[model samples]
Target: MLARIFINRPVLACVFSIVILLLGGISAGLLPVAEYPEVTPPIVRVTAYYPGANALVLADTVAAPIEQQVNGVEKMLYMTSQSNNDGSYTLDVTFAIGTNTNMAQVLVQNRVAIAEPSLPDVVRAIGVTTKKRAADILLAISLDSDVNPATGKPYYDALYMSNFATIQLKDAVSRLEGVGDVFIMGQQDYSMRVWLDPDKLASRNLTVTEVIKVLREQNVQVAAGQVGQPPASRGQDFQYTLSTLGRLIEPKQFDDIVLNTDKNGEITYLKDVSRNTLGAKSEDIMSRLDRRASSGVAVYLLPGANALDTADGIKAKMRELEPRFPPGLKYAIVYDTTPFVRESVHEVQKTLLDAIILVTIVILVFLQDWRSLLLPVIGVLVSLVGTFAVMKVMGFTLNNLTLFGLVLAIGIVVDDAIVVLENIERWMEKGLAAREATMKAMEEITGPIVAITLVLSSVLLPSTALGGLVGQFFRQFAVTISVSMLISAVNAMTMTPALAVLFFRNRKPGKHAEDKEALPWWGFGLLGGLATVWLLTPILGPSLGLTTGEGHGESAPGGLGASLAGLGATLVLAFPGAVGGGVLGWFMVRPVNWTLGFFFRGFNWVFDWATRVYGQIVGWCLRFSAVVLFVYVGLIVLTGFGFSRIPTGFIPMQDKGYLVTNIQLPDSASLERTLEVTDAVEKIALETPGVAHTLCLPG
Candidate 1:
């Protein structure tokens, strides 16, 4: 019924296809691209700092109380905590892979709130930091300085860079779209370091602790009360608040801080015991870029934020912020995940396009007419464009998995077009008019087309129900393929028949086509199978590396061999693989057409024998159905056993032109010790073959 409506008006089909094409084109640009589906388990971190405590003390005093409260966070899978001898503690609560992190975070935050009262006063004053961790770092930016030609020293030291990054860069970057948090790494905030001399303290008859106490007391910040009365009647006199700039700002201010008032009417100020100098806080982190001392910031993306957008936004922000930076310092992207994502996506797209062109060329080869290629071309184009539109609506991103799904969709979409158009072309070659041929083709193919759609959907749809990370990842793939196949089925019935009816009405029979009947079902089964495999070569082709002229004899300079190799490639290169393949039977036939025919003849002969043998086996199986069932069960068990021996992972690793390596030294290692190991590892990586560079992450 639906096919008849579309067959009557081919114009409507064309309009529908154009609309979908437009929608897909627009959505492709707007869709957020990422490296992987959101498969990482959600993590919420709870942290506290208790000054002057060791790791054991910190764990017992801070980490333990917090973990005890946050242990039962809803949807949480497990919790892990770390305590550092520097008096810092971090409790990390990890939820299930697919849990809604926002809700999980809220639940954990509530629990942590209850435990905050039990924390030490120092820890409480420092504030317990609780947050849901953002997705992986989108970009890492390093702020480095160049040596001044005017001065022997570099423009600014590490302390200046650290303060500038914290105050300037972090805020600018965090304001960008999709950015969750911009963490300033390897930065001990600017501070005044009071270097007290034990010798000076003893001579002054004061303890080192007494000196520290005097300095701390002198740096107190307080809000003083107003000196004037309230303005109950209109202000009779000007009012002012009694306040003092209590906290010391400059190094000179500490000189007046009294360390003690001795027996005599005399005071010993801070300068008597120690010299105060401007510096940064105690160093707990070390960051380096290519062996240069530096500081950096790591930008992260919020959940569901477009990674491509966030990465690009970060770079754009850095560019805008770079100019205002201090003399000789500039921001450079030290690490980025987006480039790999963009390149992989581009490769997959190029492959998909190649496959489509190759399929079209194969259609042209078998049918020997461009008009016969029309319906199949429209089917593929419509299905692909429409799939993107659906993806946007489904909130699916363009990642490796969805791209994989789209790549697989090529075969399904083409298969349907092949059935519809091939049948119509065969009937048309038999001298029937276009309408009569389409009618007859539809009559024979309609039921099978519908059934094929159902079978394909059944095969693919179950994957969407997968319960784990792999299931979430490939759901896009499974849904895409399932949806695309169903779409292809619809197009085959409606648009394909419409196009055949419209185009075939004016067609003239080919001279060779009149002399013989087209290949029968089994003949097409043999030939069509070969054509499909041949068409898949461009997409399935191995990636090759470029060679320099150093090895072996002089290069076999490009000539006819390269040209002919590229001839089929020209189509795929232009329209990409699948599109260019339609140009010729010669393209597929290559140096020897007859050899292909010879191979085809051999295949037919082999298939004939296999079929006869299979028919006999089927008859025997029918007679002994119980034994056949038992044999099938035995094979299933054997297959499971064989598969069990093979190693498995959620998805195979792909070389996306990037590598992420993580190393942890002993838990008790200090920041300096960590950098020692990191530099050693970085040196080894740089010395290794094919390794271009390495970035040691901030400690």
Candidate 2:
């Protein structure tokens, strides 16, 4: 048929370069070396509290019945609530983009358990907040110490490395494996400060709620209930006994316990009045660069892990626990996203090795021979070693947008081996011999090189049905430029016509009658289609930087002049951005469809019964082409209920960097006058010239 594959061109280029180096070593050992891709977003939060109510009575008793039962869950989008007369209440929410924060946390814990028997049991806890990126923070810590460097330490400490990188390394990187949470600001957690004496509690008539019930029932521990095993005579399995004794470690054990007694067995203690002090609790803390005090650890990277191998195994376990710290405590990890995904996968492997050494020096200065530059550099390394062995058997990873779509398909993967080696050097200058010029150049370009590599691999096959997160980042850059241009059009049809019938025979067709009167067939197909219309006329005519005297002059176009200047700039900029955004959106679509047609004419009789159920889905799309392809796959499975009615986000919060600053003061402000209003807001963030550095954390 195709003239028996060049009658053994070096055993078909050594069995298609050993089956493309065994599928490019199994797609470079199965792809997935990610840093980011599998996204969920659609956030959630909730929270609650209330004890001494206030933020307008805890936002009308616990954030309005938990935001009216999570405002009808699915893709809610905006919720935001917050109250704080120091008796908090939250809300947050934010769904939409394929919302499913684990089924929106079981529909917000069954709509906060149907408004928990109408809340108000002095509401205490609610919490939800997940929207996983393993709950954000893919690594941040940054510590370096030597403290008392004669007590200087001033080197702009990013909020003491963001609160000792989240409370001394986020509870051991939130116990590692795909860590979900580890947020820490600058520093916090160490409290105890009771300074009572109001005239010795008015000569011991004691009150402040009886010194907060003798310091929370002498630092609580209670258990008692359960001491059964003794009545076990017949039916076995009995060991029911639970006992516990209390012990409040220190602060003079709340001035020696015993509270109400006096009926005769008198003993009302607590140093009879009060004074407990032990300090260091809540008020943002994050310290590192030797100023000791630490807390800042943002490790998150779990959903289908691998963010640079979980941030290089958490910086090699923080340099193997930096000698179990203590010598002026230390830790260091400035920031990571694995060095911006290894500098964008080493800048697309230096732009795919400078576009394969500038397309092998412009095909050896325009095929000046050497077997037309070793049969198109062994047919572009056997079509990128069989497109990295089908991206290591479809595991796929060499990221940075699938290695920038395999270095922008290295000149459209050598345009059908430069059009079947310029049509077997025009049939070896017309006298054809080397196996009849490779069987008349594969029967005159085998059906336009298999219909231009199946219409350029069917233009990224609708980006693998792109569902969410921009179809998991352009479905691995459209399956690495559609399987490396379908393995460079099957190595330009069987290893460049079996290495051009064994290394381009005669190979002396360079100046045949001054290159056949300087190229004839419509003057070399109108100078190879006007160098693919001046290499795709700067995306369809404009930048006339046209200097094609060929070779490396005003460089750009290559093989088949970059596939007809990228298919005439993708049909001249996608047919004028889809017919000019559909005719400037039809003259502002009749006053925006009469302002959303008066809220969609109140669902126009349920959209006229969904247009008579899509007119029985266009009469079953022609009396059933498999029931119009199962009603076009039930309208693509009702596009997952129109993508769960759209509105979800976990990251993408851009109210510019961040600054919460609340300052108030009065509640017994001490800690050195609340660190002098946190050193005058860190001197107005070092005199803000577009600030970029600030640290005054205490809340």
Top candidate when judged by TM-score against the true structure: 1
Candidate 1: segments with Cα more than 4 A from true spot:
9-19, 121-126, 148-152, 196-243, 259-265, 425-440, 505-694, 697-699
Predictions in order: lDDT? 0.74, 0.61
Task: List the candidates' TM-scores in order.
Answer: 0.74, 0.35
TM-score (C-alpha, index-matched) for candidate 2:
0.35
Best by lDDT: 1
- Writing each residue's lDDT as its tens digit, candidate 1 over 346-393 gives 788788888887887676555544466667878888888788888888
Model 2 scores worst on lDDT over the 10 consecutive residues at: 514-523
Q: In candidate 2, what are the lDDT values of residues 1-699, reduced to their tens digit?
A: 543553554575567667786657545543445634545555556566665567887777667777787786766767677786556566657666545456766677678777766778647333434334444566566555454566687342344444444555666677766555555544444446667778877765777787777667667778766645655577666676686657565677767766666667877776676677665443433343222334455566654455654565566567677676556556555444555555556667798888987997676545544455666767676676677667655555666677777777878878778888888877877877666777778888878888987887788878878776777667767877877778777667776777677765544544452221111122233334445554565554544333232221122332234435554555554454445445545455445445544544455667689899999988767776786787778999899888998888744553334354667789856666766676777676668776544433454
Clash count, predicted structure 1:
15
